[model samples]
Target chain A: MTTSKQSAPISFERERPAGKSAARYILGRRLSRVWLYTLLIVTGLAFGLPFFWTISSSLKSITEIYIFPPTMWPAEIRWKNYADVFTIAPFARFIWNTVIVTLLAMLGQILSAAVVAFGFTRFRFPGRESLFVLVLSTIMLPWQVTIVPQFLLFRYLGWINTYWPLIIPSYFGGGAFYIFLLRQFFLTIPKDLDEAAKLDGASNFRIFWNIVLPLSKAALATVAIFSFIGHWNEFFAPLIYLNSTDKFTISIGLRYFVSNPFESDEPREAILMAASLITALPVLILFFVAQKYFVQGIVTTGLKG
Target chain B: MAAATGRSWWHSSAQRREALEGYLWISPWVIGFLLFALGPMIASLYLSFTEYKIGGSPVWLGLENYIRAFSQDKLFWPSLNRTAYFAIATVGLGTVGSLLAAILLNQNARGRNFFRALYYLPSLTPVVALAILWQWLLQPQVGFVNYALYQMGIDGPGWLTSRQWAVPSLILISLWAGIGGGRMIIFLAGLQGVPQELYESAELDGASTLQRFFNITLPMISPVILFNVILGVIGSFSVFALAYVATDGGPNYATYFFVLHLYYNAFSYFQMGYASALAWVFFLIIFILSFVQIKFSDRWVYYEFS
Candidate 1:
């Protein structure tokens, strides 16, 4: 990656024509550079404008939002709209519920995925490859295939309308994708560490806990962050399992705000935008802070067969 | 071979211990797979043949649900068609758009990271927020999109409100949010893996920029392209959140996707058995599509390192 980056500018420089008049060549090159930047900046704005619109609209007054020739900046920024979001619904409770579910899910998903990945990477056991392939195959199976039966299973277990339905699955395996990711990361770790740990009288579980995990922080962080975002953004399961408004995740709560008839009459677009922003802020912030891990995870998954 | 003793490997106690430990370590996933994945799969297959409502005992229907879906269900085929349309449009547009953006970003330009981050910001936004944001942006009257169109002397059609434009509008919104996203990052990584010497040699041989890209850059990154396409297919087919929040498969069912149909049957109508049938059909479709993709990918996907 570094080699490609370094060579890129040199290649561009080398592509210059030697026979061209100096001033003309410089002028053409400058124009092309300007063109390139202009194009990039335009593309950037197209991608970035929606986020800008989201944040800008969240602070606008309802009437102002409806104004023709819509203003990019709110004429009078209403920070109180953020506060009003909570009053409009039990958004605070939704956030708390989401936080609880997300945290527990993330913990279970990372730990279970790591353990499962460890088993796959460290042991030359019977049927290991076949089991791993089975796990990978699950990634392609649409969630709908199992959703109905899973719903029934959970209902029969008396876990409907509870966070248990959302959280318990994470403790089992989290997901095949996460397990595959951690397994890839685990394979990169040298087997000598396990041997050394064994020589020190550490059990396989102890070596996995102490040696393998400690060295795989970046991969673990990737799993943790992905799990966090996934659980936080999950809608269908929470919608199906939890019937009570108080137990609603933020995603469902935001949907309720949009469709709730009592609040429909009011011009609540600004507040709705505000609520959306709040719902998305945590993941957005995490992306900025842990952008490296996010990129690494994607790259690893893409490059690996 | 050296480690293999003059005895059968199965007879070794060490190997047995390792196998036991391995199973123990992976027991969580195995248990989960049975309880969650395989168990549900088998249960759904059985349920698909019955007439199970939420609270009632399942009555054996024996292909009634499948027959109803194939012969009678009004929304089933249309929803499947709509989902296919959505998948094709998004996957097609997303792949080309992201690849182009990646190629551009791969250029040795200033403020690359800043631009990368800027473009990536939308992807990090929750789908609920993205749907809401797009809803406002695509509003026929007061929306920014129409407003901008009007500014340019073009009348924007009713987006979410119009049956004609609803699916297309959702596709456009998805492209806007996703083109600069993780897919783009994956493409960027792929772009990086293309050895610069290939380009240099091509240039030395008087290859045009276009020729070099087609001949060198694309072939080098074909494997990544294949990966993204597969993922894109799976994702677009399963798209739920945006449609659920933004349109609720509305505008005269223009956006009624396959999953939404299944969701309605399973949850709203309490036709668990029928929904299970729908799910199994969906699974088969996806499976075939994915299998076909993998089968055909060999023609285009070039794994340079492998």
Candidate 2:
């Protein structure tokens, strides 16, 4: 919605600030524009420079990395650092683990959230509003409150050191936030469609499957993109559950990379940067590719709340 | 909209079936809620009052762990104080920064989207990646941040290394990565919702820009601001991975916040009872903070519908 969001700044040609006042208004606007750019450029660089450093440093030669007043551009791009990242540890396996958890969790979260949201939006029953309130309340409930018992529960189930702990809970309900998001989206879909489908003797599940799910693709994609970034970046749970190195996700794998049995020597900072870049690359690509969905997710939740 | 049946009362078998179907459709979430959320919460509450370090049944400790947290644990009060300080700095600066950035980005122009994307880039980076990257960037001797400071004849502090700057450094990292993301977008949405006509009217009334901002923009978006601050406080309070990685609550425990204390107690020291008590305290603080904010927000928060 922020795309070309505002109409041309309330063009009130009538009774506008006149004469020197108009010029002063224009001059004030110009002065503020100058200030805006000054702040924007400074902060833009503040945000962008670290990313630039990380990206450039990832490709830098080890010597270039240590150079005083680090070079903005690498003198020689060393693709070797990227390759060396794989040899140093089970980096590929870590990526594979992260991908598996993210994919499975996304699938679970999307399907279950869609189902729950449909139930909440399409069907009305006794205490429905109260039940929905309960669902919404969980959004404010911090994961920390439930994390210990959850860890103990998982450990007791012998699900520790496996992907089960990471992926299983997602199937039950994606989360309260996603449920709320999709519920909002679902409420906007005309109930006449469901009624039309039902008039044809369609089952509730049939209408949900054939009519609602297809129409909700955009909302679902928003959830999916958020899911990908969230799961990819998730560090806390994986840190607790997957203690074995061979089973580690990229987040923790990189954490303990220095002591990898595969590499006796400490890896170069460039190589580590390269590894970090690799870990962060997929989400970045997804962001640029699906920037609309990601930003829409933010705007939707922000304004709707 | 009650249902397709359009019946609030289940007088007919069809209405009954609709009710059953609704329940059936929502059953999975209900099960999950019970198993994961409600069950665990109740268990943790019970565990907080009992000592259980796994491998043995919980010995009923009544209020010992709670008492210990208040009076015994050396790090508990200090860590909480540290966390409160961290929350104030990060949330305060972050909300203001995001609001300012949103105001700036709201202008209609070319390259606005580019700048918005630039601003959002850090938030997309994984928290672990951010921690490590900042660690490298703030390296006392070789860091580029210090190098820049040197150009200005200002000696940059040790940052994550110095006890004095550890919390500040963590706050800086959090702000750098977070200030431009969702909260900014929220503020942008809020700003967009403030009718352009209001500004046009204010302009005709001869209100200065500062006057318009104070009287119009601020009041219009106060609800969003309140929501962001509440979320920001909750987020900053429980933040773990950044500190866990950047400093490990370190450089002499200056960056050790409340959650890390709970984490170490439960996971590292196996003080499950104590950790649960800490967690309950954390939950209650968040609950009360949210409650108080909502209760008092009526004084300042303007709701359009109401």
Q: In candidate 1, which residue pairs clash?
A: none
lDDT per residue, candidate 2, B96-207, as tens digits? 9999888777664347778988898888888888888898889887777998898899989999999999999999999999888989888877776676677767778898
Instruction: State which docking tier applies to candidate 1.
Output: acceptable
Scored against the true structure, residue B180 in model 1 reaches a CA lDDT of 87
TM-scores for all candidates: the values are 0.93, 0.93
Task: Evaluate model 1 with DockQ and give the value.
Answer: 0.43
The residue pairs found clashing in candidate 2 are none
lDDT of 2 by residue, A170-201 (tens): 99988988988888788878999989988999
Q: What lDDT score is found at residue B83 in candidate 2?
A: 93
Interface RMSD in Å per candidate, to 1 decimal? 5.8, 4.8
Report the CAPRI category for model 2.
Answer: acceptable
Runs of candidate 1 exceeding 4 Å displacement: A1-31, B1-7
